[model samples]
Target: MSTENYPVVFGTEDILRSLCDSVSRVLSVTTQSQIRYSGMVQRISKTCLKPDIGCFVLFDGGFSGLVVINFSAPAAMELYEQYMLNMGMSKDELTTSHTSDEVSNVMGELMNQSVGDFTAKVARELQTHITQNQPKMMALSKQVILSVDTHLEKPEARRVTFFTGRNNIFYLELAIDRTEFIKLNDFDASEVPDPDALMDQVHGATAARPAPAVSGTSEHDELLNSLGM
Candidate 1:
């Protein structure tokens, strides 16, 4: 008989942290921003309501789910400004505040990268393939109320919040059918590298890098850190 790899089973918490890690990676590479997880909730609570903007990305494969990101007004504005600047727009070009269309577009692109990263991370974690749908952005006057698919037990959903280096807070919600998530579990311990081994690899690589000029290295690092790099 032919054999096939199975998807890894992950708890709601594992999924939330992986998504958060994906967000952090996207922010770091795209916006040069840093983020840390703030909190998580297992259901659609009031806190997940009334977001200024939202982006939804669907996933397929053995691990089917939805990732919905909601940005607060301040968080949206901050990200928009930085994203525009990174796109080479001048401050003068940004004299006016961002409109709904602009915010939606920028956030759509951001979430697209984030969810793409999430899928990659999930694939590595699960040691199985996963597919993602194109991200869809929604501009809303208030939060959306998603209808539950009765055919599938109430989706195992969670709200995960993260704080940016600039102290801005934004959150994303993850929803996967409970049965699907459980079915996907086929965890392989060997797929995950040892933490100590990874740390040694990092240290070894860092040790091989040439020393920076003492006078300017700190200043340069400070500048990048200020930009949340």
Candidate 2:
């Protein structure tokens, strides 16, 4: 078979499961909240992007990826209240008058710690060292689509929601390009002839087309079957 015929297969389910486990652990420890895995969403859409405040942390190693945790304003305020209460602050002292700077600082610290825990989990699963960029807050005013490769399938993404208590819900999103994802998992590339060259060729050929706006596991599975993986 030609070198180009080699199949590429990725286990997105396994990746999302691992991430869900990691987030559950981190949130439970830091926020003293009970977390339950809700469900997974295949695409980044307006419904899922409803949260206005979010913190994003970048992961870099064999592959580049991001871990984003989003919170509604009310949810953010609730989390802040819970955190302060945990720190021995009296409920009487807790007030809504706290400036954005104060709320953002606490949120940023929690996000930083959460990302640290997540990277540690990823390192164990991938058996490779993982480095993360500083976590930062972002406001989503409109819908945003992910970058995809025309030569390959769209990136795999899953959103896992965790219900704490009293209707407090928070979510984490994991999206990774299929090609880089395989690499991050330490897939064997020995059989491929010039893997880097092959990737360059494929990317060059698919450079002109725009990435797909929607994604699903079924679509990715179809692509995998077509590749004979």
* Candidate achieving the largest TM-score: 1
Candidate 1 TM-score, C-alpha based: 0.66
Worst ten in a row by lDDT for model 1: 145-154
Whole-model lDDT values for every prediction: 0.70, 0.64
Which digits, one per residue and each the tens of the lDDT, describe model 2 over residues 54-109?
77767766555667777766667777777888888888877673336666677778
**Model 2 lDDT at residue 197:** 97
Error of 1 at 41 (Å): 3.7
Candidate 1 per-residue C-alpha lDDT over 54-103 given as tens digits, one digit per residue, 9 for 90 to 100? 67777877667777777777777778777788889886776344346777
Task: Return the number of clashes found in candidate 1.
Answer: 3
Q: In lDDT terms, which candidate is top?
A: 1
